[model samples]
Target: MPDLYSRRSFIAGVITAGMLSTATGYLLTRRTPVTLTLVTGGDATGGRSLLINLWNRFNPDVRLDVLTVNSSTRDQYDKFAGTRADIYNLDVIHIPRFAARGRIAPIDPPDGITLLAPVQRVSQVEEGSARLWAVPLNTDVGMLYRRITDKRATDAEPEIGRLVADRTQVRQLAAQLATEGSTTDEAFVINVLEQALAQDRTILDERGVVSTSLGQWQRALAPLAAALRDNRIVAVAGEEKTNAAFQERNLRYMRNWPVWFPAIDREERDKKPGTAAIRLGRLPIGVLGGQGLAVAEDTGYRDEAEAVIHFLTGMPAQKLLATYGFAPTASEAYNDPEVKAAMPHLEIVRSAVEDAHPRPMSAGYADFAQVFRQHTYDYLYRGVQLTDGFVEGMQGALR
Candidate 1:
């Protein structure tokens, strides 16, 4: 009877030991649930959905909710400042101001991620500083995009002079898009500024103050003033109107960013992607445009929020953005096989980002942008003279 009891005890001991071992393994591998919310701009390229869906599918431990806001920056700042949102994806130009106002917190981007140098520089607290307020998610440069039929635009101009010698053709083609209602896509303020940049001149200096002399401003703006006076381009209120006009075939050329490529491609949905109807080329100069990811201070799940941010700016997300025609800020994305195949003008985009001029930084960047537009609006749209007062108005707004 004693031997039988010992055998039974031995069996019980083995069973208990097995259960404890299994429990220990489970405890070590188990993950705590984490939930985070992110705020971003409108997703015209449809990339936000792709990224969100991917994160939810793979990372069972983390749940990320994304919100898209279409309102102006001011309205958004007012509405979401104290909300439950943990991550903020804002324009690169506004990062400095966002950091200054404490709307978004400075971050340390995860290792193994590389951002475009110019883009990184713009998002810094100071030039060449080790500090960074945000991580650049994507980069942009205004390029001339137009639709073509039958033949490639390259073949059409075998000796294409690029923007240097061939811009005249682009202009002439835009002027001749239609006879009675001929118009080229032109968004106000941005058009004037980009054109000035294209001419190798800038009105606002690095400090966000007006720095151009009267003669320099006039020489740089002569083409636009003449175009407006001659009715060569329409002063559309914004990019939406400009793109709408372009889509309706009322424009042979338009001033647009890389983000609009997806919507424009959809217009020719029936055509093969390899022989797409649209052709894109770079301008001699480009105004840097893009968005960055920032964290909100005093947020719950700080670690999880930053983890999601790392994922968003990581290589996988960058590649997905490239597929949608949005310029990915990751320099490696430009070299990824899938990304290169997705965008035939990859070099054009890369060069643009590399050579693009960043907007002047100021704590009051919004006011500066408005002041610039207000001062240049009449001069650009009404063909009025760009006067000394125009410069003063811009200079005053920077302060």
Candidate 2:
């Protein structure tokens, strides 16, 4: 039986090799069909499957092999640097670094391609001069999730001024809810990192300068400190934990991404009698997040790769992505009746995306982020004050 199993494996290997050889022969002879390799991040949404199906139907002669890389953006860029993949789905934050390193090719979008104005701005990364480094795929932005109640949430979108006012209101609301028999310890939740980024107070500026001054850091973190002292805001570890706490109804208001709306809605629907109400609203500005399609510089099938990118970012594909739970980057996708019905607060999301700020576009952004995270965490959770010494340390880390 062992010998038979080994013999079967050998036969299968030979058959596979023969099939590959025949395909290579056909490719060499025909010169018409193109097989493009795409390396991208994991598909939490069903967008990738929809894209492949649409591509197969629209361009029958083009064969696409997608390799999903579920890792950090730095790791994704490293893998692209070492591989021969024709296209990449890169995190937009890393576009400047990848473009600077020449790991990805600059894009020249086809005529008639319409990108949401804000998405287009973020997709173009400048090395020496401004160039379209990637085509916008789906987009994401930070948002405020809260329990619906008798009092309407702020009608105005979230902005720095609004957030500041909201902080005070949240404290007042916590006191009011406590008086009204609420026993929860937390009234609001926000990530220190999100607040800092939303207010354009990153460790570094776009020009690779250390831009987070002592005054700026203090100003940016003052609200967080106030909330922590007042026990009005629960500082969670990250977005996942925050979302989990909110889902358990331990929180009244939370700052999170738009992706969690569907799950929150489901929870709201399943509420019995006195469950915490859930609703979604816009953050005046959030940290911009989403992936972009980039072609590798050395790809042999540049034309075909570009075509795949075009199909992925096109209106139909964007609509499909919206249907699959991703925030679309095309304006038309937000306007689609089906998409609107599915994502009821899409306009709020659109406003947030438009006003969202990208993280500092430095090659050393990972380092910058690390420094900010460490310092911010210490201040928010570990009882460290934003002193002159702390500010000095952060400045050094940014450098």
Candidate 3:
């Protein structure tokens, strides 16, 4: 009886020891927590807020650090090249440039994941190949914001030269608004480069050759030049300022992106009685703008980084984007009942996005854009004539 009891105790002790050892081994070999850095452009507070919230909700184990480099696409590329950021939210037009320079890694999404047709088409980078280089986060297109009392929105394409001729029409519009008791101080605020690009009049051709001629550029800038001289238009630095001017009800028509819808709605809601009202309308043709997530080729946590990308570009995130007033890259998000309710004119925005054209895609796009911007600024703001020599100088700058 004594020997039997001792043997039973020994057996129990050995079993307990084995279990402890197995548990310890499992814990030792477990995966460690991963930290990823995400760098993007634009308003860090608005769009980044949504992303951070979603990340915390979906990826509790991984740590996400976001940085906003609110400068040019060139600035973003420079940061990505110099920093250790695990992921980059780059402009879709810059994907080819980044991929060509080996600044970003090609992505292979999981089997069940898919992007909208237009976004998917843009996501593919390499010529003559189906390799997806980036994950589309959102889509943007130029839009016109006006007073709700304005005439029914039309798709009438403006004649570039006629619209800016002597600023006569713009001055007349301003006078008409004044007569109607509108407090608007400006008739228009034009983004010359964006307008030109949206109209498919890019400085560089598909072959990366300088394609813009003096006559074409003159037609594009003539309207803006007239407005500047006549004080009928205000030349804003970018969209943020344009949106601000429009929000203050100081301008009649403002060209901006659809992302401003939510803020505009909020302004309307918070306005005091008798404040200026605002409305959104489709651009005749919009310049496509948006960002895509690209993983760093040297990231140690490739799988985790990819998972983060999947979550961001996923349905849940896309739905949140739509709700937050961004144009989502997923087709399903557009059809979402709640999203439609939040943005009544989402259908119009969708149509505009469908018709929008992306900027020129080239390895030298940065240089081309710089040249175009300089020439346009001089022509429109500084009253520089669009001469043959000016065109030659622009072409030379492209080289």
The models' CA-based lDDT, in order, is 0.61, 0.61, 0.59
lDDT of 1 by residue, 61-143 (tens): 67778877665643445455545678888777667767878777667765666777777788876677755787777888777
Could you list the CA RMSD of all candidates, in the order they appear? Answer: 13.8, 12.0, 14.9
Residues forming the 10-long window of minimal summed lDDT in candidate 1 = 176-185
Clashes of each: 0, 1, 1
Query: How good is model 3 by TM-score?
Result: 0.76
What's model 1's lDDT at 211? 65
* lDDT of candidate 3 over 127-171, digit per residue (tens): 544567888888887676655433355534343333435345453
Per-residue alpha-carbon lDDT of candidate 2 for residues 259-283, written as tens digits (9 for 90 to 100): 7676565556566334434566665
Ranking by TM-score: 1, 3, 2
Per-residue error at 96 for model 1, in Å?
0.9
Q: Which whole-number lDDT from 0 to 100 does residue 192 have in model 1?
A: 59
